[model samples]
Target: MILDAKQNEKPAKLTIKFNTDKGTIYLEVPCDIPDYGLQESIEKIIEAKCILDNNSNEGLNDLYIVEDKSGNLSIMTLTEYINYRKSIRQDILLLFNHD
Candidate 1:
């Protein structure tokens, strides 16, 4: 999973994405103000969602939540999730182009 943030005139846009064997999941969030407070809140919300969905006991650090399992698994916020999905799509396109 990955999380990315962009700043615009109107609001701050955040996207989250994850890759799974089934496919991908994404989430996007737009905030009126791009402040640390808002960012922290958003991160917490995303962490909670990830915990609930994955049924894992983990904690959030920086922009992502670390899975305590013995795997390179990471969860992202909703917004980050969306951006990650987009990134994956772009990678697929690049791969096909090279082929």
Candidate 2:
């Protein structure tokens, strides 16, 4: 997955893109964020997904904690999680280079 965010005169926008068997999925989250907000936002996003998926332990591995809950679970592969993290980090670095 690739995550990128840019801030203009208006609200900041975060874009996350990942490839799947079906195709690539993209999500754009807009907010007014500062430099330090990236990590928190990323964590929150992942955690929310985990919760929404009823905390699937299958593919989470070391990325997050799996909890006991009732519902269907969809887990992200380790490689996908790692790639997502890398993308988030890259986006943060990009912010530093921006004016």
Candidate 3:
């Protein structure tokens, strides 16, 4: 979140990134909307962008959503995030394994 010149004005944004055969695309979306609304907005944006550029969504295998948490940045697709969580859980289980 970036603070405006005026006091108490914190602005937040969601960064979306995707890779195409030619290059990578980056988009910034306002984060003031609700979670569901934000999801829909992102989906529509991606769909429209791809369509306008004559690209197929099915061919986009490197789509990702960027997130900033506590000054740290994380860039990963939904599948990657799920797999990361699973790996973390597996590590914990391995640490506590007995017998």
Candidate 4:
């Protein structure tokens, strides 16, 4: 298999913004997040954190994901993007621990 220059470079990361009247959240996410359904995963995180957000962070329509590279966008509301981070971190740990 051969990959062209465009394909070789990973698609631009998706930026998850939790914009709200109170404040805003800015997060950059890798486009090719392995084994993780982007929208669904984010929704789960948001639902999980609904209770944790005692102060009501997410506004009526303030959470969305934007891809600068390809101009793709998705809407979701996750209080914390922990699942993705944990999955990627765990993978990294295993990769480096192989000694």
Candidate 5:
């Protein structure tokens, strides 16, 4: 069912998947982010993951990005993510120059 949130409200179940060294990991991302904002959202998630896992997402280029349309899933590339970041006025260099 389509549950519409109030204006400026956010979803509560935003999630993404990633293939890690050991296995697949499902991450809970924050809601209220537009499609174009996914790039930064994912970076934030990965940054948190890096802190928790004590490793960088250096080679993890592909992301199982969940779109805003009816929970549809898509495997987004780094280029696509950067483009999306550009659309949302986020820093694109973070995708590559992360420490």
Candidate 6:
């Protein structure tokens, strides 16, 4: 079975909604990430954006509550997001590899 060019294309945009004291902040960026690396790539983009946007060192070390399009939430510090991704990957692997 062969998929058409349109069928082979993934969504090019990612929308990350951030709720702040000021109100909701929406970040829409180009995303061409593959399925296996999607979460990790999103986290990395968030971490970089947060670091660039924050004014203070303390803000750089803050924890973020990220919500997905489906309303699922995850809480993790910017510095620890990669580690969190690894743990999630391990859990997925264990689930699939279990006897």
Highest lDDT model number: 3
Predicted model with the maximum TM-score = 3
Compared with the true structure, what per-residue lDDT tens digits does model 6 show for residues 1-99? 334465754446565666543233344444654574567546755654565466365454344444443444455565565576577678867976995
Model 5 agreement with the true structure over 6-85: per-residue lDDT tens digits: 34433476666766553344544456657856765666556544543553556553443434334433335456655754
Write model 3 residue lDDT over 1-99, tens digit each, in one string: 677555545568776665655345454456676687566656755663564366445544443444333332243444765675577678757876953
- How many clashes show up per model? 10, 0, 0, 0, 0, 0
lDDT of 3: 0.55
Q: In candidate 6, how many Å is residue 6 off? A: 20
Q: Provide the lDDT at 38 for model 5.
A: 73
Candidate 3 regions exceeding 4 Å error are 5-8, 52-99
Off by over 4 Å in 6: 1-55, 58-64, 67-74
What is the clash count of model 4? Answer: 0
Candidate 6 displacement at residue 39 in angstroms: 22
The better-scoring model by TM-score among 4 and 6 is 6
Model 5 TM-score, 2 decimals: 0.30
**Deviation in Å, model 4, residue 55 alpha carbon:** 15
Per-model TM against the reference: 0.31, 0.28, 0.36, 0.31, 0.30, 0.34
lDDT of 4 at 8: 57
Clashing pairs in 3: none
Worst 10 residues of 1 by lDDT: 60-69
TM-score of 4: 0.31
Error of 6 at 71 (Å): 9.9
C-alpha lDDT score of every prediction, in listed order: 0.49, 0.46, 0.55, 0.48, 0.51, 0.53
Per-residue C-alpha lDDT of model 1 across residues 23-65, encoded as one tens digit per residue: 3444344444348645655565555555555644343222343
> What's the CA error at residue 64 for candidate 1, in Å?
9.9
